[model samples]
Target: MAVISNSLQIKHGLSLWCPQSASINRTHRRSSIGLGRVLRRSYVAASSAFANENREFVIVGGGNAAGYAARTFVEHGMADGRLCIVSKEAYAPYERPALTKAYLFPLDKKPARLPGFHTCVGSGGERQTADWYKEKGIEMFYEDPVTSIDIEKQTLTTNSGKQLKYGSLIIATGCTASRFPEKIGGNLPGVHYIRDVADANLLVSSLERAWKVVIVGGGYIGMEVAAAAVGWKLDTTIIFPENHLLQRLFTPSLSRRYEELYQENGVKFLKGASIKNLEAGSDGRVTAVKLEDGSNIEADTVIIGIGAKPAVSPFESVGLNTSVGGIQVDGQFRTSIPGIFAVGDVAAFPLKMYDRIARVEHVDHARRSAQHCIKALLSAQTHTYDYLPYFYSRVFEYEGSPRKIWWQFFGDNVGETIEIGDFDPKIATFWIESGKLKGVLVESGSTEDFQLLPKLARSQPFVDKAKLQNASSVEEALDIARASLTS
Candidate 1:
């Protein structure tokens, strides 16, 4: 099996999320592994025996999209043993976000584990365990990832030499972490990345043995893991080239709020810093992180969370949205090639609300796009992917925290930002563009409170500038926006 260089290849069993400008604004997204030598060995032994098998529906990814699509298939009564899922991971699709959040909680907290966090559960549905797949008569090939495809023949081959001809295919292979090249010690022992459950498991072991921790790149992975590191009482420091955290989304004031919380919780920041290389100890474990400025920070564990890239290596015939780094798909998630639909983080579909083709690298989109694609496949009506771009996180949810920080955003962040709340019990930020509400971000809000934000973002309601200008509280602001909608 050939390798895709310079990325953390968990060979993601589906290794996915949705598209967000190739790297999900430098990764609220990532994971995927390349087919490896061991799998290739199995190909020789199994190729002849498993050759020329066929399935009516084949999902090439075992990530969020695959799991939700499987559920949809079951719902639509189409998964009658004719549907199959091929995954690189050993387990069925569980909630991938748990790998970043609860999976990293201190061992004493008894963090989340497989079977508990499986797909659909994250969004309040049935827990689809491996047994569920079997009971539903859904064929699953674990640790046997599809390695190559023949578009003309409508067949795909797996690493274990299973040949599968599909009447229709869904590409859900997600994305892989963008890492520092090995030339600079990116692959050092103490250095870690989180793209899959396997990657998180490795990082957990490293975190246990670690004291001083250095996290590179302050994207989703960086921020989330740093909180985990701080929770473990390790000396944690996050260094990034950006001036503040979540540069692509958070306004300075908003960033300051979260940064303050992290600092109060013992996470340090070294903003505007660039990485030179990682220095490893004699035992071949990383010991320190060196910056381009010739300064070095001593460390026991180093995690890289720069960004992610889509895993579309095997399907060259599928058209690509080169601008965003994904398989190009229409509103219905139909790819450039017929019968091969792409969803989850791998499909760059038209964002109807934004009137542009964009890829989302988030779980919500992965689940929604997959369901919509399956519905489109089964139905004759033309359907469009109308997704409200959203991103969110909650850090330090474990016990003994000064405060637990959580936030959720809806719609685009491309405009002027207005903020409310003081980041004590809560905070809300709104972005208005072209005299309409374009985006909303809220921290620590109730379910009912959150319901309004997505609506405001979607409707793009005209603003009452003076009313908003005088608004002092989130409720006041909400009322103002509500009145604007009615007006």
Candidate 2:
């Protein structure tokens, strides 16, 4: 077949089809080839016309969203349609959140492995394995990523030269971790990132011999890694340009509360400082980290968690509407193109509750958005995606302490004024704008209390400043808000 920059195809006259020769046997054969080899060596010679004639549905990613979409499809009586999932990952969709948390837990804690953290299981559903796919007549293309897509032609070409056409497509490409320039020692042997299971495994292995570890960025990933490192008895230091942890999200009081807790756990913090360059030994392994403030700290391992950017290359050649965040999707998770949908971190969707468009990178969003997209596809439903913004972070626990510092936030945290309830073991903040409650945040709150906060925020109840100032507890404020709805 002719290739145009390994992406576009100018052969408009070509028809679409999917030959039965590409189907796997019912015996469930597993390929032993490594992902790198499969992408480079294994080739599938199918034309776009052949694929289109056969395929009914196709998903372009293998993360949380893809996994849930598969479950949604099968649940909705889609047992026999030709469904295919193309993914660069060798493993099936597993819990992406565990990589930065439980997967890094001490060996005694027994970190999760394949089949354990698989999709649908996170949402109390069945774990669909390779055998499950076979039983359902679904085909999976692992380690072979789609290098290009022809939207008008409804075709996808993988890195291995396999081509397929679909009646409907779901894009769940997820996001990529951010790193520093290679000139600054970002490519050193001990430098690490945690975006997938492979990255977490590598970092976990490094922790066994790591004494002094440097963590970059103050985002939840950096904070969580620091908590785990110190919990494992390693010397951990966090460096970020922000004056406090979670500077972009948490207020000064909440940041200080968590920062103090981290310090109490013996984790050092180097705030308001950026990495000048990484120092390495003759062997090219990192040895130390130099800060922009003219200070150097010993580092046996380094973890970078600066941020993430949407994985949008597969959609680039398709001329889809995109923003700096990700592919812009409607309330139903449909893209600008017909019969196409985008979800999870790669989709910048409209947040109806906030009357604004935003993209969330959390696992909850991934699971819900995928389910919504599948509903819209299978039923032609015009349901509006009204998702309440929610996120949480769990940090360190000292020796002999069974307590874990965890916090969950719901609704929008942006407002003209903020009110606090308490800041000890429990930290609660309410964001108010023009006497209207806009958001609620709480740390170490009970399940009932946490659940009530979001409902109150969604109600957008009118508030009196005097009642907020005189409120004894979060529960009291919740009671007042609840009464307002009734009154």
Candidate 3:
């Protein structure tokens, strides 16, 4: 049986992984291992067999989590022919968030774009280049997908019939967008879903000739696309089945505020409505979308952003446990089968911070969890992962501001929200909960707010609710929070 650690970090800076009693028992058992020499030798033989079969740690994805893990493993003296990354995509890992803004903007004043597989400077400024990975001695197998995993033999077969063995495996395969139901005419040419850079490129190509674009689902992706379309002076309509935008995330009041912001930017919204069927023109392009209420809206293009389903089919036949469409892992990122681990959007683990089962899709969560997994791989022991949830998005102006600002955090359970800068039309709201700062949402605040909020959220014991609400500035809020924690 695999040993699992039960630990939770509480007050003070110290981390508690296992109980003191349990540690003492483990130590005592190690000292009395004279009678278990035969069992120990057998275990050593099995481990040695695994080590000889595959000298390198094989990672089965090329995303942020996989890149970070590869770096972390190498940095910790695990290098020397001991690490390889296999990514199905042709390009190396690159940031996906900026594809809508920086990549699509004009040359002279474009935002910072993500680095691609090859270093080609577009209109945007210089980002981190992919060649840096090769410089660091990392081996990458691009466009190679592992089709099957032989768990007992610790071997993997790729789509190209290349077979490789591994002592340990890390699955970082992320999710894909949920497809429209088959009966609703989803196979239409002009209907598309955004999941990767390729999808974004296709949408941009379609937008060139699209007179009107209809987006299904009012989540962040849909809203961000709507904002971009409105910025480009395109006819954009957002159809949401929910009555309010971002209903699943924020309060109705906040959703209304966002609705007003979008409306001011000339983006039309269709609330409490669902698409019944899509109609294609004679040219084999989408011409209109028929609503469940029997109403039809003209459209040249339709983008589906309804959300994602876990990319877990590759691991399903291997008998890996999963919950809610993601692979299940323990605190140490270890799957049900030993020597195999998983992380990022694909791993469903119990969240110590939220006190619930969670599968986070944010960059910060992926990085932190990957770090913990690397630490576990090194020590060969269970390590508890504890990190605060963080997320952000770029939205339209608060009032009539021409500048673009960011909204960092939004959640109802978080206590009073404090705002800074011009709160009139442009505003920044910081959510505080239980005398601790939880998150911040910026509409027209400085980019510095994004850099500082995540750190403040992690270092707990936030400010008092009353003090935070009445604070004059961010500096004052920080001071008050510090004082409250110490007091």
Candidate 4:
């Protein structure tokens, strides 16, 4: 490799490095090029470009977690000076959840846009935009991914050949969507995965002419995309290896409810089946799907929402402690390497409430954990992160019956029995273990229900079946349940 020093300007910041000059001394400071005398000068005072390259806080990845952490740093008066966010994406952090929801809608549907769904806003806070970053003196290295990191050296090198040294580092690289192997026709055209805005845009663009669409893996992404497909008046078919949709999380009864609704909306389901290979047309686009059982189904478009894997390639040589899912972190979001922290879907942290390690892949966890990590770094607080796991989904218009469902759930669902509430306009399911509440799931609940149900679930109050059965409302039921625990 050729060795040369050149001044490379970092976007939205200062020069990433000192200019190549023989006059520069070992300290990278300026020295007079003369045989008679030598004068020394600081790089910051000599070069305007050199002052911008170094960062006090360097965060990898520009997703929700990184965005929130930056916002937290700013909120706590760390806004100016050396804060740099290196991201592979061209744009800064936005609402990634929108990629599957409103973003896939038709043009007339008025979908979400940048600066609208920015970080902190997703958590009901202020929107931090490019202008905000410029005003706050934060540097963003967009479209330039950090290719290597050396914890011992306290530095990282980006793909653009720019080296950034950090006093503190935060790893929030997030996750990547898993695609089928190329040998199995995954490389064929008309196949897509929705992980970023570009992916969503491609899928949405294809929907204009795609009438028959086959969706593989019936997880949340698949189910949500299926809803969007149905709205587009396409013939949608969802295939998965599981017996029911979200089989790992939703109970059979709840799964049936969602499955029935989808079926009623003209969506086809192929459960307990696996894709053998994709059949392609002469144009090198997927034309049909072949099942392992030797069955074939015609398809104009294919979507694989199998799952996501943490983007941890850069850390392979770094030797940070990582689990199969993500980087293993303590309650405070600190990884095995001190001064280096991990958050969001890329972090597998110990769940204090459950006393088990959990790597949650959800928006709520991402936002909270990012803040937690920053708070710990700032205050040096030793408080364990006690966060309640929460997840939700939004689906609208099923079978033209004006179907709309907004559901939220808290805690683990494993239990000996379940208590079901009225399943009409509102549905609630409580998981009970040893006569104590372990989890709560409520759909279309009243304001009071959202406010109290989680507290009740967290407290794990003992339940009185007679009182709970007689209670008419969620609040009333919770009150009666709490009384039993206290009494």
> Top model by TM-score, which number?
1
**RMSD (CA, Å), each prediction:** 8.9, 10.6, 7.3, 11.3
Candidate 3, 161: how far from true, in Å? 2.3
Encode model 1's per-residue lDDT on 278-299: one tens digit a residue: 9988999999999999999999
Lowest summed-lDDT stretch of 10 residues in model 3? 1-10
| Candidate 1 positional error at 194, Å | 0.6
Question: Would you list the rank order by TM-score, best first?
Answer: 1, 2, 4, 3
Off by over 4 Å in 2: 1-53, 79-81, 319-323, 397-402, 416-422
The sequence of per-residue lDDT tens digits that candidate 2 reaches over residues 1-487 is 0010111111111111101001111111112321222111112224645733446778889899998988888888874556888898888887788788777877766656777888878878888777787788878899999898876566788999987877677889888887878999998999998888788889999998888999998877888888888768889999999889876667887788888888887889998897899999988899999988788999989999888877888796433333335776677776655566788888767677765566778888899999988887677565688987777776554344445887777766666645456556576777777788877777788888777877877888887767876778767766776676666
Residue-level error in angstroms, candidate 4, position 96: 1.2
- Each candidate's clash count: 14, 9, 6, 1
Best by lDDT: 1
TM, every model: 0.89, 0.86, 0.78, 0.86
The whole-model C-alpha lDDT of candidate 3 against the native structure comes to: 0.63
- Scored against the true structure, residue 424 in model 1 reaches a CA lDDT of 75
